[model samples]
Target: MAPSVLIVGAGPAGLILAIILRQNGIAVRIIDKEPTYRPGSRGSGIQPRTLELYDILGVLPAIREVGEFVPPMARYEPGKIEPTSTARLGEWVDPTPDVPYSNALSLSQDEHEEILRTHLQTLSCSVELGSELRKFEHFSDRVVAHIFKTDSDGNEVEETTTFGWLVGTDGAHSVVRKQLGLSFLGETRTEQQIALGDIIVEEGVKLNLWHMWSVPPKLIALRSGGATSKKFMFAYTGRPEHIADKTITRDEFIQDFYAITGRHDVKFGPTSWLSNYRPNLRMVDKMRDGRVLIAGDAAHCHSPTGGQGLNSSVQDAANLGWKLALVQKGLAAPALLDSYGEERLRVIAQMLQLTTDLFHKTFASLHSADKSDDSGWKRGGDLAMLGVNYCGSSIIQEEPDAVAGSAYMEAEGGRVQAGYRAPDAPGLIHSGTPTTLFTIFNTASHTVLLFGGDLEAVGKFPQGAVRVVEVLPQGHSVGALAGSALVAEDREGHAYTGYKLQSDGFTVVMVRPDGVVGAVAHDTEGVERYFQKIFI
Candidate 1:
């Protein structure tokens, strides 16, 4: 019998995992507590890495149809006459030679989820709305889920189903997490209450960029909504007493909006959405418990300082979905599931720490006493959408003489070192189109990047075992690299270079389908050894 997987939550994580699993021929059923799509503009940005993942799912164009791309971010100092502006964050650095997504894209969560829902419909599986999970029991063979749901006629019903695995893609207050007795360890910024609303701005007020006002009493951010609606999200921090009434009047919102924009003639309309949210940074020590596991906000909740929450959640789904599918198919051992938590927890820790630093910096900049000569806070350099790396894990191999460098890396004269993502130079083509390494590589599968050596070495292995791509750099051209459209150049004029592999040494870098570096090697011996250790 085909193994069944039960996923709790119909949000981005749950839906994306369901799609990936279903594509792999796994039986998946997704349940959400909400009866229908929540009518509101919650999250409104999709990072570049996530865009690449969406492209893999063949939904990038659909996202772009209703999405808006926010221009380079700008940062201002309190009471300052000038602000620092950049075209993109440091995270937009060059794409790895094997991965394709190099830039960030902006879209509302509602629109993103809607597109995902539509795509799910085309598949054999669908999300069961109003189907709330009440409890579950896990056995050695399968997991039994107790589900409570309401039918179309407003009748409540209960059902019990058994599945091979149960994934909690629910929100921070995930019932699955709660049921597992997992404790969320971190701090919550209770004083930081933000008032957010989506509304129509007055005529002649063009909303094309993400505008922020670094002033006292509040820190406000304004960005354009997607193409479908002439809507905009206005957010600002306020006092608890100010919103104690739990009622944010339109007049109050417009008053603050005008105060920041210095445009008093602007008129406000009925808001499409309004809510107050408090920032919290928390993570569960363990993401998996027996036959149950957690992903997205259910596993870790961080402050939305750098907009990493949504992107990371989707990534969690990508990382867990495939592993679960492989185990279900009997292609991989059950131990492979343990790597999911081990790998993702490390990534989440980095994200939490980075965002927490941003939170402190943003809040500190509100006070003049906290101001320093350091321009680190300005230019928003601290906000790196792509500077994250997942080395030092069970999957990634460390060189005996590995030298630390930047977040990305490059090989010099046949010697590979740790630092930044591997660069994508020229002479690399996929399906006849010249592309960078990342453009051809993604988190969809475990990628075997073979640098140098003849293709015959890879022929020994089965075709499905690995994705083999050769790197041959002709020359370095800034335009050629930029044209690849994976990453933009920094102010330092330092763009990643594509280097040709030398000799028959053959450097094999294995990247997990979720974009994490699993292992690296220099010859077929190490590659074969790694395969034995991981697959067996």
Candidate 2:
């Protein structure tokens, strides 16, 4: 019998989860309360890490076709632009050409979701929009869900299904979270924010960089869309009266825009979508109970300071999706699922802390008086994107040669530590395909990184279960000759640095499907032991 998984919410998290599960041969059914896709530009920036993940999922090109790259820029005040943080777009994709997407692309959330949906449609799994889950009953063996849906004519109907597990990828106000009786414990910032619609900007005003204006009572952000469209997000200190009425006129929006930009000659065009949102820094106490799990905003919601919410959600789905698929197929033990909460919770907590700090810094800049020391503000802004780290989790290994263990010490933790995504190595190859370590390493159920040794000894494992690659000396490694590769030479003359082997023999580092280090062993004898411990 095939195991079935139920996912609530059709947003990015849910949709991406469905695609991954389906790709892994798992049966998935996704439900969403909304009848149709939401319009307008909600989040317009996709980080470099996300682009890397999309490449692994084989959808990077599709996303890039509709997306734009945002050149980094610093804005001290409205219309006052300062040149800062700039990278050759896509350089981070692989640090090598054989890899897919190496750069961050800017596209509206609507376009991103549409591309994901199109990919999902190619699979057997699909999202059931307009269908809302009324309640769920968890049994010892199976979980039953009651779904209430409204038809095209607005007729109500009910349906029921049983599944092996249920995942909540719904937004912050997730009904799935509500039904589970989970406590969302955190503080909601007292400030209110208004993120306006996707509108066209007048010609001659450059829309290539993100325009930020630090003004009292509000910090306004103008984000450029792919090619032509433009959108603005306004974070105001006080809650305006009648904001909940949803009847804000275009004239009022224009006035606010002018006040933020301090430019009266600017004209506003039609808005495609408009909404007021109160930023909340919150996370559920637990991400899983019994056979139920949660992802995305349903489990955690943070300020849009680092633009990490969507990326974090997608990553959560990526982690849980493959595990659920393997468990359903009886390829791994149920204990593997426990690592999900243990691993993701650590990440969520870190993101919350970083985002909270970002909120304070961004808002503080907004409230500061003229000529105030902007050094602190500038440092905070720069650190926002480089502050995420995943350490001290069940899945990541504590490598001896690992760098500082603190989350703040490095962005996303040092690649060699536990709970961290293995860093890319330049000029690595797999199956005659020219690619980086990330491309070869990310294609398996678990990643087995062999530092420096012959591959024959480690080739006994199940095919495709682990990826085996050789990290050669700098001058000898293929990356050196590949011209485009970013391979580095350390004191040992190795093609890479930062990873430590526990022993001289075949050291096997098993990275969980979610990109976390699951277990480590120095010899083949430790394989069964590691498996037994994780299989339950």
Candidate 3:
């Protein structure tokens, strides 16, 4: 099929973009340079915010089935039977009605990719393995990609196709980024090197926890929280000079394992995969070049210290996919695509600084307790990614009432504001069904929420592209409105409290497809004006 979008690199970002675009009735073709899906548990941390996106995308059920909470770390000294130090990986916070997922979970990166692929398959799209994008160029209105695939006799057959848009979800050394003549400026850590792998071990080794040995110049961490078939994820790094940037042999691994753990009964078994490399911190200055764009590692890369790489990339896809869909449907102008870079680049720059800071702090904390804060590590609420917002975006609009007391609109505690993440409120009965804001937020479409608005005003909504929801305040005439088929009762006042709707005027909050509030208006006239800037 001739696709509207040709996505390069079928990793998390590419797969997610494809899935979302396909779900929204846009044709997409996703191609990967890798011959097969990569194995081993690399980039295994799924942040709370990414988990929420997974729920909205209809993949949380599968992800939850295979995912596990981050187990506390048991730090040990060399040749010692007992642990010398202990630090919980992260504190577990109970789920709130507003923030359903409040902590990070671990799933092997490969497992995470598999889950994305599974859902993509359900959308009648699958990754084209062993297919590589060799070259491409953008014309006046479309992008043409040159792809090479192996034929029946192992001969390379080249196919060239044109797409309305081209996206590179490729990696740090993305061909798309290179082709666009963009620069990825960052530094490489020659001081850090490690041999990481997934290996089977004896039953003496326990599961559901981390085994860590942090001694200056050398470190070894073994975690089994999301292990498949009882195989532990092993990362061995010590003495940058001694660490090899290439795969190590079994004998070499065994010697290093014993040297660190000082345990004889727990033996190492067969290895499934091995890789050695020093990570780099890099990001593209711009995420788009006309019709060609990039997301995920193709846009930015950093040390995996804070586990933000994957989550950030998935968000990149989530942000770009819907904008591309809207543009493709002719509902929005192509200029809407420009905001993808502006909004995402700001977050990426912040992430690079955050991850780099954490990378240094993690190494610094090895010898002494962190005096900066009670938490030895910096994996706190910020790391949950719930705080990441696009409040600075050009498309986000807020009226005077929403930001009356502040110099500018800001994210208040669980309050819904323009450009902030739409807060979730439970105990809302819609169509005789009990639901939260998230239930209606599952679709890849604009949602206009009316918190105590006139019932007849629902006819003013932009048809087909928006979901109109009328939320009635508690004890404020509990009856369905003729303007909306989906009317809700805020029985517990969570919606009223979250929206600050005690005022007399109707509070109209427009949420973008990616969950960021697009606009806040006082009435139907304001709603139409806000959407006129959005839909063509």
Candidate 4:
């Protein structure tokens, strides 16, 4: 049987979107043009917000076991083995009840994709490798896709299939986007180029630190711990055309590395992967075109300076998965899918600007006379992505006369407002069992958190669409609650503190499947009003 959804590209974005859709019982098929899984340490930084999403998807445990915190950076002079400055990449923040994973994690991109593919297997779905999307025709109700692949007998095969929808998670050179004719408007930074790859380093080189060298003609940086402890991810600026064009031999590449770093004592084994990276600050004009949609690198591509590319791409898939599931299941109107583009375009725009600014700051500091300027290295604040929101999205709702502030920026004075990330609250008692907000939230349904509300008076919304959880203050009786709603007593007051519930009145916080606070209503009627915009 043909799948209901066809996802082109089996990268992190495509794999994650398939997982979310499959979890919601949607039929999906993911394909990649490559014959085998790609290898490299591309976009290796995982932010805190991404960790929260992974927890919801049940992949956090494996990621936590294999991933390590971002290592501190060690700067060195041209030929000096020691006697240099060392500092952390970003200030470390201790975890709190609201933000359990506050620090960024370092794991290779290939390993990351492998973990995601492994998780997808448990769901009875897997990427169809060696299959490529040749062309696709989009109609109002369905899409016809032409696929090209080699059969088991080594003969080439061409097949035609149909799907309810098509999504492109293919990288920057997206055939789907080009076929859709969406304007990819942005500039290419010809001046900024670097050679990135994964290589096995010789013994005697420390594997716990990220080493940086400001050699005369080029800047070389090596990040330790790739697919193995012996491997390192290396990046060198001042790209030569020969290297970019892949005309440089392996010996010449090694010679250039030794020349730039002046470290002949450290030797490197055969490289596993190599590519020339030129920053492209570009974004598509729209994310959707009728029955077809584009996401990740297809919709937007930016510099890798702040490590926002992969994280943003993962979140984009998360945001679209639930919405598309609803539409495919007939649980909501087709217009609900439109919100995917609406919500993500804003966040992607802000991210492109943020990353571009960081890119310029980093290169400026490196070229300037002041070698001690570490301000560009500092990452936190908005870079953590905990502050990214969708308050301006048309689907989000708040009380009348409420000011709908900007999206992706921290609220004034740390206030949790509508359309912000639903903060996690620990130390809750659920009918004599310990629970937390994150444990209750899943990728399948909306989690309606009622704080200090009368269970009987709360009007009925769509039961199939939401899970009602009534939260009471500490010391309150969490005894058998009325109706199907689960009762949770805030044993440590973290629920109220994390959400900033200063008022003692009943408050309803509707958390979307993607973990964004869709609405903060004062009454049950307001909650239904918000649902009206989503459900048919």
Candidate 5:
């Protein structure tokens, strides 16, 4: 099939976008520059907000299988490897009725990408490896791109293709970003250089917890790979001038490990991969330009502090996927794509500041004399990214009546309103069958939820674009409402409670495909108007 959407860079963001678009029956061609899959343990933190998206995309179960909760970090005292203090890097939080995924997980980006790739394959789409987007030409109605790929003989071949839209997930040094002339404004921290690598440790090493050696002027942290992972991911940061030669051999790596930890019992083995990196804090001015757009690291780049980079990048793809699919299918106006950047830019800017601040704090803690609670690895609900919202977006319509009850609920002190992350509700019995909010949210399509409203009201909304689901009180009957559009009984009132809908009153809520509340209305009367702003 000829692809309507061309996605460059098959990282987690690009893979997710392709999966969503293909699941919606939109043709997608995803390409990656790297000849093979990325091999690294970087960007391993999976925030809670991202896990919700994975649930919507039908890949949560696989992701959870390869993921694990963050372990506690042991800070060893100077000159003594045995005596030290320990603190939780991130404590596991119990799930609530409103939020099912309450905490983040530690999973390698490579593994996460494989999960997305597998899901995309289920929809009959596969990423093209050894493919790179050379350039793109924007036309009035479509964009044409020239892609470079190698054949079996390793000969370069250039192919031209036309697409309804294009998205760049091509990392910080994005070819599409450069070709579009979008300015990436930010700075690089040269002084905060870090030597990072994945290494296999000897037997009998404690594998569940992270070990940190924060001797003054030098910091080395060995974080757990995952639940079943045998390799530990390590990083070194502080003084780069110490290694003047800058050549790190296996012996040198082991020597440095002992010097930092001051322990002779622990043994370090061969390293799988090694890299010296400096964090780049930068972002493009905007996300869209004419027929071409950008998402993920191509649009924004930040320090890995708080583990926000990978999660934020995938969230960007999730936010953009449904909008592009809607527009391409003519269900939504082309201008509807404008909200993609309007909704995400502010959140990304806020994320940059938060991560940068944490990075500096960690840098300061490593150089400070007083080793208090300044380890800077204190990730909490704030890092979960569940608080991101699009209240300022024009497409998110909030009725005045909805402002009273449901919209006022706090998620980590942040309001859950129209344009905020939609909360999950449990114990919904639809036609005598038990279900939850997540079961029906698997598709990248608008979900219309009617609380105590007639099924006839669903006809007022768009047919193919909106999926109307009714939630009524127990013992209430809506027999054959609009020919079986799915009616649910709030047996435990968990649906009403989780959504914070007012009792004894009817309400209609529309959730965006990306798992955010797009609109809330007291009745179906405003549903048409709310969708008019979204669809053509």
Candidate 6:
């Protein structure tokens, strides 16, 4: 099939959006201007909410196999390397039935992209490296783009293609975003610049703990690179005077490391990558412009302090993918695409506030009179991103009780609501085998869980666009239902408890393709009403 979607930039956002659209059988062509897959440990933290999304995308297992938990930081006082305190950046929590992946996973951004790329390839789509989106024109019906492709022999060729949609996942200085004329409004924190790099530590450093040192106005930190033994990722707040007029080099990194830690004994090897990172609290005024849209760094940029940059970008793609697929398939009106920006803009606005506030708090605490204050280093709660929802989104239905303004509010006491994350329930018996809700949920279509065993409700939705499941109580026989819907027995009552449903009560939950509860209805009429908004 010819590609229907043209994605600019093969980073996580673009890769994930391609993966999702392809999962729905949407053909996509993803391109990046870079000569090869980029390498770096940029934005290494994967929040719990992202893990849940990856679970549906079938990439979580590989991520978990290679992903390492955030290591404890070995805090060292000046001139004293061996004697100091150690602490984890975030508290580790045991997994629950509703929340299977509770802790943040740490793997370099490059490794993360490789996993996503591999998954995309499995779906029969590959990213076009050295293919740059030079220009694009968006019409009411389609997007026409001109791309520059450099072949192996260094020959440059230009091609024009028409696509149903165009998405810019290109980084901060996005050519697609500039063409759309979207306002990227925010300021750069020049005072909070940090030098980041990946290097080989020859000796005298352990891989278990992230080494840290405080130099009052500057902070230096290093952690082991999970993919390789001798490699490590490090960051240092460089002194303005030292970095004023010189280019960043391996020698400069070595000098900064030695100056900050006073550890002349620690030997260093080759530097793989180095960059001067200045935090920018900026986001586009909107995420879409007709047939052209933007996601990830192309749409927003913020501090790396809370590790929310990449996670937010990935979520942006998740939120937009299914919507675009529906529109492309002609299953929904074009206005369905409007909710993509309406829903995400509100969430991104709050995320910017949270991350920006966290950034200020972390740096303020670090440079305070009490150098031993670790309060700012603590992370959990909202930082885990489990609370992110589209409660007030125009697409959500029958959620009168859901708060309209904030997207960060968690469903109180595990109470399920429209727009909240669809909770996962384990110990479900499907065809005499134990299975979980996460495994049953489909990423390509909406999942309608019929707790009342209303087999007739299955007829209300389009066949391929929705999957209907009948949830029976423990010991209930599935023989009574004669329908196409899959039957799962809640053998351990986890499904009822997690969703706040009584054993005999009938409840219908519509889990969106993104794994968010789209509607909590009392009957088939409400379910039909909800799908009316989603489908034409």
Best by lDDT: 6
Q: How close is candidate 5 to the true structure, as a TM-score?
A: 0.94
Name the regions of candidate 1 deviating beyond 4 angstroms: 1-3, 64-66, 72-102, 213-215, 226-229, 240-247, 255-262, 369-385, 403-445, 452-465, 469-500, 503-505
**lDDT (Cα, tens digit) per residue for candidate 1, span 106-205:** 7777888999989878877778889999899988888999999898899999998899899999899999999999999998777777788787775533
Where is model 4 more than 4 Å wrong at Cα?
226-228, 240-249, 399-406, 455-459, 502-504
lDDT value for model 1: 0.66
Give the worst 10-residue stretch by lDDT in candidate 6.
238-247
Q: Summarize candidate 2's per-residue lDDT along 345-379 as a digit string, tens digits.
A: 77687778877886677676566675344432332
2 against 5, candidate with superior lDDT: 5
Q: Please report the TM-score between candidate 4 and the true structure.
A: 0.96
For model 5, residues 72-176, the per-residue Cα lDDT tens digits are 777787457553777787777899877889888888777888888988889999989999898889987999999999998999999998998889999889999
**Residue 482 displacement in candidate 4 (angstroms):** 3.5
| Clash pairs (backbone) in predicted model 5 | none
lDDT of each candidate versus the true structure = 0.66, 0.64, 0.80, 0.85, 0.80, 0.86
Give the per-residue lDDT of model 4 (tens digit) for 407-491: 5576555555677889899999987889888888988888888887554534455556678888888888865556646888999
Residue 300 of model 3, lDDT score: 90
What's model 3's lDDT at 455? 42
Summing lDDT over every window of 10 consecutive residues in candidate 3, give the lowest-scoring window. 401-410
lDDT of 6: 0.86
What lDDT tens digits, residue by residue, belong to model 6 across residues 1-536? 88999999999999999999999999999999998898988889999999999988889999999998888878888778694888888888999998999999899889899999999999999988899888988899899999999888999999999998999999999999999889999999877778788988988678767888887787888877763567888877746855633446888788877877888888999988988888899998888888899999999998787888899999999999999999999898889988988888888889999888888888877677786678778787888899998977778994656566477888877788888899999999988999988888877899988887464756766678998888888778764565555888999989988898987888899999999999999877888889999999
- Per residue, candidate 3 scores C-alpha lDDT tens digits across 297-410 of 998989888789988999999999988998998889989889999888888888898888888877676655442332435475677888787765677776554442211124
